[model samples]
Target: MSLPDFDTFRAAQAARGFDEVVARSWAPDEDVATHSHPFDADALVIAGEMWLTVDGVTRHLRPGDRFAIAAGTPHEERYGADGATYWVGRAEPG
Candidate 1:
């Protein structure tokens, strides 16, 4: 099956109580040091690839892959040579 489009992602985000929906793109071979966000996140890899590290486990993410991170979970990110573009939904802690 194919990946969902921005419209589909937006609808899901709204239904899931994610008040913010953003499109994020990383530069080729970019590396992000360990960090954490203030809100929960749900994302879909729509282009290229990325590595997501959370709790010391690294996950290779590709197009159509989905991942989620709870608020304040320390994590790291690395983008592949072609970089990556994703649609992310963020929900603040209630």
Candidate 2:
């Protein structure tokens, strides 16, 4: 199946029982509020750089990098000077 465009990605998330799905190009200094999810997540960095805080520990993610996060984890994100574009997936199995 073909991948959905960024505009329609969130709909896919809803269809799959995901709390949220985000896909966008971020600018430097962009910040995502700290939050917790109830399911597993996979994030892929498409360009630039970012720092993700997971359970109080921060991990840097760069282009071509991917990360998986477990359920019920608290996390937040900060963009780097060059910013970043990423695809984030969050889902719970039925």
Provide the lowest-lDDT 10-residue window in model 2.
1-10
Per-residue C-alpha lDDT of model 1 across residues 1-94, encoded as one tens digit per residue: 5988899999989999999999999999999999999999999999999999999999999999999999999999999999999999999987
Residue-pair clashes per candidate: 0, 0
- In candidate 1, how many Å is residue 67 off? 0.6
Model 2's C-alpha root-mean-square deviation from the true structure amounts to 4.9
Measured against the true structure, the TM-scores of the candidates, in listed sequence, are 0.97, 0.65
Tens-place lDDT per residue, model 2, 27-68, is 898999988777787766777899999878998988767787
Candidate 2: stretches off by over 4 Å? 1-22
Q: What is the lDDT for 87 in model 1?
A: 98
